[model samples]
Target: MFSVWKISLLFMASLALTAATIPGKKDRRPLGGWTDVNVTENDSGLQKALEVAIREHNKASNDQFINVVTNVIRARRQIVAGMKYSLNVQIAKTDCRKSDSTPENCTESELSRLSQHKRCRFVVYLVPWLKKEELKQNNCD
Candidate 1:
């Protein structure tokens, strides 16, 4: 029969192995890295709004998808253009709530640890594109 200490050591080793096998949270990202899209010819307001929406969305959730709603609203209707734009943003899933908030106070090592969990998510909608034709529509094929 194995001694008491010998059995205890074996049990501990088995426990460690089991823990190691458990999967940890994955680092999620958009299909491609950060993408830059032209918001409009010279519409800074629309750009700011889009950035704000993305930041807020990240705060609500760290998932790898964004929900953009295209409905006619007062503010959205003002930005009339011959073309439309789309932006799919993704933020890291870390304990750090805000992108700016993390860089200021969190250390490299600390940030590395909190990146192993899942969180809530939300979406927003803006519509100013349905009226526009395709990019090459005006040009002959």
Candidate 2:
């Protein structure tokens, strides 16, 4: 006794529900674990590279910030897998200086006004750290 419209609506709703309930396939590698390494506050190239890497990684969201360091070097190959875009990154010669308080403790305005001089510099790579082999290959000591 259902009307054509009602049947169609029910079918569509069922389809939507089924799709929602089904979990997506898991990715072997996820980009959520990565971070950005900027030599300066306004370094567009580094930002673009990070953006490209994130896009290539197919991560769920791009609102998060990642700090690329030596620790991330182990996953370097995975990170750069589909990155077609380019950006200049350098090995951080020195450690990044810490602020008196954690990022959460800082005000939004203060965080927004952050500068690159406070971060490390080495300009060939944008990640925080590099593996020995990767470093050697990139000529980044």
Candidate 3:
């Protein structure tokens, strides 16, 4: 048992050292699939994408309660024909039910059946010239 504990500690230390020595690995290219973008929660583009994503999700989801973004974890941008944003966000359930309400006026729901929190990854595509925003994907856990 002592030997196993010592070995585990040594292994963990080695893994930490290895990680610390490794350089951030990625070649930032123009067409790279998803590159981290410098964006804040206040960024209009990112905010728009989040709204569109949530709205689209609500439309497609079977859940009666609506969900809204609580925070943005990560946001990445990809260039193809248009700009595609891949965002990892924290979302929580709201008091509003999809059947008769909208998220704009809904508050967070903390009640038993309404309490739900999830990390969602949403891909939103934007075409500025055409003034369009579309959701490419919405996945949550």
Candidate 4:
């Protein structure tokens, strides 16, 4: 007993509601326990991603910290859905500076590139969802 126009209107309203409910591409912070940094062609992007991951992990786990080992940064950009990053980061659980060293003021990026720190080598792979399995099998440790 409903007209075609009425049915179409109802369908459109339902579609609109569904679209509104779908989540946007939010900058989802890295999962709590492990920190993951995405490597991009641009150094700035890599640094930003690493910083975000570290911050996320620290926020989630107050008693633990992820320390970036500056000397060991190896990253490759992946060509997927345009361009994505695959960052190979070496991290430790302690801060980069030691308790005895001269307290030096350094930026996050600078700290990532520093050479002196206790190393607890653990590799984490980050890729676009599409290439996740391939990257994971090859990179994750």
TM-score to true structure, per model: 0.25, 0.19, 0.68, 0.32
By the lDDT metric, which is better: model 1 or model 4? Answer: 4
The lDDT values for all models are 0.39, 0.35, 0.80, 0.44
In Å, residue 102's CA in model 1 sits off its true spot by: 8.8
Model 2 regions more than 4 Å off: 27-141
- In the range 51-126, model 4's lDDT, one tens digit per residue, is 4444443344444334443443655444444334445555444443433222123234535433344432222234
How would the candidate models be sorted by lDDT, starting from the highest? 3, 4, 1, 2
What CA root-mean-square deviation does each model show from the true structure? 22.6, 15.6, 15.1, 12.6
Candidate 3 lDDT over residue span 1-141, tens digit each: 569889999999999999887667554354447677666546777777777898888888898988888878899888878788999998887767787888666655432364667999999998888988898888899
| lDDT measured at residue 72 in model 4 versus the true structure, 0 to 100 | 39
Q: Quick one: RMSD of model 4?
A: 12.6
Clashes of 3: 0
Leading candidate by TM-score: 3
Residue 56 CA displacement from its true place in model 1, Å: 2.6
Better of 1 and 2 by lDDT: 1
Model 2 error, position 48 (Å): 53
lDDT of 2 by residue, 39-131 (tens): 446555454444334333222223233223212221222244332222333222122223233322323234232323122222123343432
Q: What is the number of residue pairs that collide in model 1?
A: 2
Q: How many clashes show up per model?
A: 2, 17, 0, 3
